[model samples]
Target: MREIRQPGAYSYVYGKYEEPIATVKPGETVAIYTKDAFTDQISKETDRPSQIMSNPNPQTGPIYIEGAEPGDTLVARIIEIEPTRDYAVSALIPNFGGLSNTNITRTLNEPIPEKVWIYKLEDGVLTNNKRLSFPWRPFLGTIGTAPALEAISSITPYDHGGNMDVPDVKPGNTIYLPVRVPGAYFFTGDVHGGQGQGELCGVALEISAKVTIQFDLIKNKSINWPRIESDTEYMVVGSARPMEDAARIAYAELIVWLEELGWDKWEAYQALTQIGELYVGNMVDPNYSLVAKIDKKYALID
Candidate 1:
């Protein structure tokens, strides 16, 4: 397996022009070492976000997928996600988060107070050594293929799937991403030890991760957005403003996916109304994200 180590092989933006740090053939599996969202700057609990952190969510690569081309589908099957460190950080950053007064949503109220919390890895759980404890629910917070014409910031999520922060992007899940440029310049970072729906407070248990992934290509197949398949469910993700729009985009794509599975458009739409489930990714990024999902049993019905 090819390995891409972070700090050296990383980018803050997803762009077609960025040089790829490594290249691998289809069906090849690779191991990636990634930094936390703060890039290891907030290691200690006393460290402050404004005092130590500069850039956010540094992505692990522009990995060139051999022979990948526009309109093709890049298949990434996440086999494992292991935290390489013994701790994780959760913080409340001022001017960021869902309920806070942010740069975009101006208000008379003051921004939320900034504070930091650290979780120690012990007995397979992240614990505060007191009352709070969370299981090791690891997932990739930022993972995407580069866009063809735009040098988009890694902080935002869009068609090519940047930092969607969906908790469902975990091990044993295979995510399907769109390919808009040759080689597919793939990137991944922002591993979280655990995160809740919507990533409500704009942060999770941020930690470094060693992620093993298998890559393959679906030739000439194009998807409007990112999709995921697990043993029991299929999900589609959408990133946009006005939370409802995100929901619409996600379900719309899921409806199309159902149609491809032999269901009629109207029938798929009608079925989704009763069987569909929704998951919130992040509410803090430039564009909020939402997911529409369906169980495999109903999706593959005869």
Candidate 2:
């Protein structure tokens, strides 16, 4: 196993794949250390978000997988996500989040007051005000390969899987990403201690983390979008605006995936109507992400 620390191994935007800091063969495990989304600018004393750096969400790497190439699928199996800090932070930004008046959803009223809350992580739980305590469900908030043509901001989630803040991307889950460039140029960061579906508040329990992941290559297997398989379910991810469109993209991919597995298109549609589940990954980002999922037990394949 190789290790890539935060120093000198970070990207603020996803673009033409950069040179790999480290190259690894398929099935090799790499431990990556990532900084918080705020780039470690916010601390217990930090009150205003404007004090942070302009370009946030620092990702770890563009790791070059030995056999990965365009038109293939890169399988990233998350082994572990351990927080490197004792405390995590969540904030109510001035004009961000699902409920607030954001740039897209303009309003005459003033922006919401900015408030930051720091939570302590202990015994697999995050607690802030004692009245509110919840189990930690740590996950990487950003993970993606470089886009085929254009450069994308680290905050945007798209087919290339930039900042898709999906909670399902946890340990034991395998995320399949399409390779658009040679070596796949994979990168990941923005560790979240825990977050609800939709990431309603615009932020979750943000923390730096040490993440262990194993990579696998599926030669000649191409996928249109990112797909994830946990121990119990198979999911397709989609990113777009107007949330419903994201849902549509996700379901479209799921339906196609089912059909490819030997079920008739209509048959897959009907089956999905009965067993499909939709989860909102993040609504706060530039492009909202939705996940269409179904249990593996319901698979039509023998």
Candidate 3:
């Protein structure tokens, strides 16, 4: 096992195939310490987002995986996500979120209040006000590999899996991503103590955490988008705009995955119509993400 600490190495974008901070062989586990999405910009005293000028969502690393290459599959098994801080923060930025007028919504009304809420993580629960409390379910909000050709902002969620704030990306799940560059420059950050389905406010319980993940490689096995295999379900993720397009993309990838698993295309489609579940990962990101999932019991893969 290797450990990579967050001190000077960080990235604001997903591509460019930056140099690796560490290299590990397939099946090796690495523990990474990551910062929150705001890069710890907000504190109990902080009230506005403008106080921070640096690019947000600073990712940990583009750790090179030995034997991983373009056209292959990189399997990352999330072993654990433990918060390094006692508190996490969530805020409503002026021009961000689903309800607020964002850069895409283009509303003339004044932006929403830039309010910040700090939640205390204690005894596996996150509580702010006496009325607001929930179990602390830690997960990485951004985890992925480098794209084939372009440098994408860490805020965007695409095929290469940047900032896909899906709750299912927690421990006990293994995410399979397609390799687009040599060594599969894998990096991750944006740890969240918890988040709802839509991430409605464009923010979740952002916190710095230590993530333990094991990496593996599948030679000649490739995928178009990210796929997740959990204890009970197999899921395919698709990220795009117009919400419906994200759903379509997810279903399409699910169908392809089913076919690759030896099921007939039509049979797979039919099964999905009955058993598949569609989950909206994030509608507030640059690309809305959706997950198409089916229980392993119904997978019909021998």
Best by TM-score: 1
Error of 3 at 67 (Å): 1.1
Model 2 TM-score is 0.97
- TM-score for each model: 0.98, 0.97, 0.97
lDDT of 3 by residue, 1-302 (tens): 66898557579998756778888899899899998988887878366775673678999888888988899999999999988889999888888898999889897899998888899999999999888787899888999999999989999999999888999999999999999999999889999999999899998999999999999999998899999999989899999988999999999899998888899999999999998999888989999999999998889667
For residues 1-302, what per-residue lDDT tens digits would candidate 1 score against the true structure?
Answer: 76778536468898888778889899999999999999888877778898887789989888999999999999999999988889999999999998899999899997788889899998789997668799999999999999989889989999999999998899999999999999999999999999999998898999999999999999999999999999999999999999999999999999999998999999999999998999889999999999999999999998
lDDT of 2 by residue, 76-122 (tens): 99999999988898898888888999888999889888888888899
Off by over 4 Å in 1: 7-9
**Candidate 2 Cα outliers beyond 4 Å, as residue runs:** none
Least lDDT summed over 10 consecutive residues: which range in candidate 2? 44-53
* Position 222, candidate 2: lDDT: 91
TM-score ranking of the models: 1, 3, 2
Question: Candidate 1 at 189: error in angstroms?
Answer: 0.3
Which candidate, 1 or 2, has the higher TM-score? Answer: 1
lDDT of each: 0.92, 0.89, 0.90
